[model samples]
Target chain A: MESLLRVEDLNVRYKSYRGELKVLDDVSFEVKVREKVGLIGESGCGKTTLLKSILRILPPNSIIYKGKIFFKNIEIIKANKNEIFKIRRENIGMIFQDPMSALNPFFKVKDQLYDALRYSVHNIKSQQDLQQMIIKLLKEVALSDSERILESYPFELSGGMRQRVCIALALTRSNDLLLADEPTTNLDVTIQEQILNLLRELVNKRGLSIVLVSHALGMVKEFVDKIYVMYAGQIVETASTDKIFSEPLHPYTKLLLSAVPRLTGRWKAEGLIGRLPDYVNPPPGCRFYMRCQQSNSNCKIKPKLLKLNKDHSVACWLYGDEEH
Target chain B: MKSLIISNETIKFLLKRGGSIIFTLIGLSILIFILARILPGDPARMAAGWTAPDWVIEEMRRKLGLDQPLHIQYIRWLSDVLKGDLGFSIYTKRSVTVDVLQYLPKTLELIFVAELFSITGGILLGILAGAFPYRLPDNVVRVMSYIAISMPAFVWAIILQLMFARIIPLFPAGGQLSSHIVPPPRITGSIFIDSIISGRFDALIDCLWHTILPALSLSFGSMMQNARILRMGMTDIKGKDYMVLSDALGLPLRLKIYKYQFRPASIPAITAMGMSIGADLGNAFLVENVYNWPGFSRYGVTAMLNKDLNAIVAVVLVVGIVYAIANFIVDLIILSLDPRIRRMSRSV
Candidate 1:
């Protein structure tokens, strides 16, 4: 399958008062055409940073040490401002964590969506066409009262409604790839399920690729085809969603799976012990060495991500001798 | 239908705001009346010279209604004020209301021109400072505004007069216009407007030339304050999540700043503008006095010094009304600009 997006050896650092914090260290991943990928990690593990780095939207103090991000054969890392803008407008759409803050408070829903449409899609000809398109998009998001929703400000809407509007906005220009950075983090469980289902339906119907970043392990399990387990700014494991759940290779992945509370009486939940390594002065070798129950003397040397099977890979000394 | 709905909303807002403003003005009128009466010098005694006999003073007090009980005096004053009778000035013997009207236009013209410059120039400088915070332009504006804010309007008036009028000789030193130029017919009483009505270009030029120094001096502090407030607001808005979203959507820089950022950020700054206007009116006393411009501030100051009760109360009432109205307008602008406020108000 042709990859829609590929990131290679991406290292991102942030200048802070203490020191240079290594946020994304040699991160490598890929999203194939129409594929749904999930990046799962604990808080402060640089999952959101990876998504931001792809869009080149990191804060001013952030420094990209070494990386190559290719989107549809275009090297996005080397792209100029105009090219980046065009790429963001035409190729990629993003749904932020907080829907309330994402939409401007001062603007009506219609005006905000109109601005998004104006910048992202080039084919809009007139005001009437624009309105029609907006109404149609709202309908796609299952917003039946499109006129009222469009006319009202974002503050007037419930959290679920606002999230739906945000979804509609992301799908406005028919973007090829949608980057959802914890889209359901600020939502209730019921709304989270609804949003996840909506995203699944949109991806299936539109044949759009998605990279969903989430901290919740169980939430993205059914929606995503592939899962990349991240720890301390590194992709510790990558596999088909079924394989990651059934026979997780990395210790961190295993720890995470064990931590998920089970309803059945047999399996006991075990929380992962130890803290995330301080990015300012991370360990010389394996970042998870302090917490990994399987860590050995060999972990002092960094282990490369080795393919165990056609659909499974792990970055651990335990899988070091595995064949690609 | 939309226009009808909007007008309905506007009317509701106006009625609510007007009720509060009227209440404030009434409270202000009473306060000013009490304060004016409690002033040091006796108005009746002052009206009569120092050598006047007790009978003369007593007769003068009777004529001015000063001998009446405080409540009767207050009631009489309030009733007369409600009827648009401001009474007569103790020193000049001119009707207080007419005197205020005659001198009011000069002060209004000065304030109008100053505020026009202040609002436009302040917002522009603020946008520049905010957009490029910590950059050279921002640094320059910060320094300049600091200087402007630190120096009082009177100090600015003196320095401006010295530099522009004395050394450069660019503008007139003082007064409304050149003494030699025959005054224009007093249609609105404001020299700027009256000169234009009378089609006297020379007089208009002279009026504007004389106004430049005083107006600039009067507005300097207010303009600086406005710039600082807006700059702080812009900086705050810049960090907002919507700003990032706007950028992510690939919206143009100008649209992001002006349409999205400016309106939300400007609420505090715009509200501050009303207070700035009131402060400028107060400062006009010093500015007008320094420049020898015949304005309400000058009249008010003279009345205060001479303990002219009627004139003092009249001037205070006008200033209070103007301040209250300015606040009301600012509230309306805020309601229009902010949807959150509108929603809150609507729900209430």
Candidate 2:
């Protein structure tokens, strides 16, 4: 499989008055060409941070201590200004969680879309050409009434409509990969399904890849081909979506699956016990060891992600025989 | 040409704003009139002179209608003001309207030049400081603005006069033009404009040369205030979601700052700039005294000192009107800058 985006040993930390919060601790992730990869994690698990790091868009105070994020063979972290800009404009596009804030309130939908288009498409001949290009982009996002949508500001649109516009903005100039950071987190349940479906359709139709960072297990199960379960700034497990659901290895992944409410039979949605480890002074071991019922004396040292089955990996003392 | 066609919403906004301004001016007039009446050193007494006998003082008081009931006096003054009669200034010994008309243009010209500098200098400094916050430029502007804002315009006027006028002798010390240059014919009543239109470049140069110290003194404080406000606004805007997205999209730094960041960040600064005009006019009096510029603010201070009731009221009213007009224009500018405000205007 051809890898479209690969992040290796990415350690990101945010500087605060207290100390450096190790947000992304030695995390490695990858997405293949035309693949839908879902990154599932709880709130403050650094799923969004991972996506931001991939695009090198993290805040000024955040330091990428050790990481190499390659988007289509271009090293994003160390790329020069112009090179990074070209990659962002032509290769990768990002869709933020809140569509309301993602779109600049002052600009009309048309202007924002046109502005993005203008950067990528230099020879955008005339006003009519630009107008037609925008109309086409709007149509691709399933937005009818292109004229009215173009004329209206972000505030004027509904949540779903704004999300649609955001998606359209992301798809400008034929981007190869879409980084959707909890794109449906702020939408209604029904709207969430619609947006997810729209995204899947767009990705498939364009032969484009996507890395969807989300907290909802059910949403990820329905949308992505593979899943990477993140717990406290580390990818604890990775497997085929169905395999993770059927035979989850990591204890945290097991707890997460058990927590999902069932529609039939005895609906016992067991809540996981314990809070996330404080990143400022994270335990030097499997981050989930505190909450893991299976923690032993061996759980004190950090566990590297070790493969136990074909196309399945888990970072746990129980899975790996190598003791270090 | 198309911009001249005001939308119905704008017309409604203007009418609503205009109506409120009139009410505010009326309220201001009543307040000023009452304050003027209660002030020490009676205007009638001032007009009559200390050597005048008891009967003459009484006659002066009667003639000036000082003995009339307060409300009657207010009504009389209001009616006369409505009829374009601002009464007479005992200090200037001229019609209050005439004195204001003569002095106001000079004051306005000074303010106009000062404002030009303040707006441009302030916004430029703001952009510079905001773009590189906490860096060398930002620190320099921060320290400079703090110092400038701490000092009043008059203090700056004295410092500037001493530096440029006396010690360096780069510019003239005081007044409108050099004594040798005969005054240009008052076409627009503004010496700068009159001199230019009448093809007297030498007089125009002299007028401008005399203006620099006073204008710099008047502008420094307000310009610093504008810079601080806009810098804060721009810094706050830097962390917005759109700004992050713009960075994610790798939009050019200049494009993001000018196109995306500037408009939203400029709102607070624009509001401050508008309100600063009123403060500037008030401060201009002290500055005028220091620079010896013959402007309306000087007349206003003299009117207050001599208890020139009519002149004081007229000056206060004019200042209020100018302030209100400035705010109205600012409201319009804000509306245009922010589409959200435009939407709000419709609901209003």
Candidate 3:
């Protein structure tokens, strides 16, 4: 399958009052057409930064030191403003973490959707045509009260309902790739499950590609075909979801898997010990070296992401050629 | 049924706000009365003059009802106010209400023009500053607004009069119109409106030309205040997530500014406008005195200096009532603009 998006050797930095913070360090990932990929990490691991870099939505102070993001063979990092805007309008849709702040507060739902349609879709001719499209999109998101919902402001809706409206908005233009950045983080657990299931069903029905970013291993484990475990701004391991869950290669990945609580298991839950390395002046070699129990003098030099099997890749000395 | 419910809500809103305004006006009347009495010079003595004998001063005090107890005087003044009698101006010897009616329009006209200048100029400058913040245009606006805010209205009035009237010879230095031209027949009592109604184009031109310096001077502080408020609001709104959504969706810049940004950012500016109206009216006193403009503010100054009790009270009451009404209108506008406020009102 052809990849829909590819990010290569991406490094991002944020200039703060103290100094430059290295946010993303040589991160590389890919999403194939109609594939469900999950980016799993603890908070501040640069997962959201990676997603934003792909969309070119990083804050004004952030500097991209060296990186290349390609969407369907077009290098977005090198693209001009108009070209990037066209690509974002036509190809990519994003669902933010906080639905309340995502939508404009002063505008009615229908007005916001109308603005999206006028820019994204070219075939919209009249108000009636736009209204029909919005109604259909809302129904697809399982919101039956389309008319009332369209007239109401964003603040008037419940959190779950607002998120559904946001989902409907993302799907308005039939986007090829959807970036769900912790889409269920602000919702209740029951609503989170419903939204997850809804997303899974939509992806299957429409053959949509998605990159779901979350810190919850259990949530990402349920629907994603592939998972990338990131720690301190670097991808530690990438593998098929079942393979990673069954046997996590990187030590950080193993600790993460152990952290999840299971009802009937011999495993004793334990969190990864130690804080994230300060990004302003991170340590040389592996970012997780201070917390890794398997580190040796050989681990001082950073290990490259090396392929172990056809479908599994790990970036640690344990997975190096000498070990095999 | 919907219309009836809406009307009912309107009535309730009016009663609540109106009751508060009325209470405020009464409190203001009492305060102004006490303060006027506390002023050093006695109105009866001032009217009788220093050379007048004790019996003459006593006769003047009796005629003016100044010999009564303070509470009795307050009740008498309140009854007279309720009966539509504002009493007589000690200086002009005309009814206080009549004198106010003549001078009030001049001050109102000045305030109206000043407000027009400030609101339009301030909002535009604010939009420019906010849209390209930290850029050249924003830097220029910031420096200019700072200068405007720091200078008093009287200083601005003097500088403008010197520059435009004396040095540049562009406009008249003082007064509402040139002494040679007779004003148009009074309809609304505002020279601009009266001239337009009577179809006196020359008078209208002269009236507007004369207002240029005074109006600019009067509006400078308020303009700066409004610009600062709106710029702050817009800068804050620019960072909101919705703005990010707009950029990601590729919405046109003009549409984004007008539809998405301007309304929410303008709420603070609108509220500032209401508060500034009362302040501008007060500041008009100094501007009017500097320019020698015949307005209610000039009358107020004269009344206070000459110890004209009735005239002073009348001016204070009018200003208080105008301030209250301006706030009431602003509240309605806010209610319409913000749904949160409307919801709050409903709960109340």
All candidates' TM-scores? Answer: 0.93, 0.97, 0.95
> What is the DockQ (computed on Cα atoms) for candidate 1?
0.72
Best by DockQ: 2
Q: Distance (Å) between predicted and true CA of B57, model 3?
A: 2.3
Q: Please tell me what DockQ candidate 3 reaches.
A: 0.64
- Fnat, one value per model: 0.70, 0.65, 0.54
lDDT of 3 by residue, A233-315 (tens): 99989999999999999999998888877768665678778889999988788899988999977677777888899889999
Candidate 2, B1-348: lDDT as tens digits = 332346777678778888898999999999999999997776777898978888888998898888999999999999999999999788788899888879999999899889988999999999999988989999999999989999988899999888988899898889998889999998878998999899999999999888888999999999999999999999999999989888877787888999889878999999999998888999899889988899999999888888999999999999998899889888888767777756656522
Q: Between prediction 1 and prediction 2, which has the larger lDDT?
A: 2
- TM-score attained by chain A of model 1: 0.96
Chain A vs. native, model 2, TM-score: 0.97
Q: For candidate 2, what is the DockQ?
A: 0.73
Better of 2 and 3 by DockQ: 2
As for candidate 3, its clashing pairs are: none
Candidates, DockQ = 0.72, 0.73, 0.64
In TM-score terms, candidate 2 sits at 0.97
Q: Please state the error at residue A13 of candidate 3 in Å.
A: 1.9
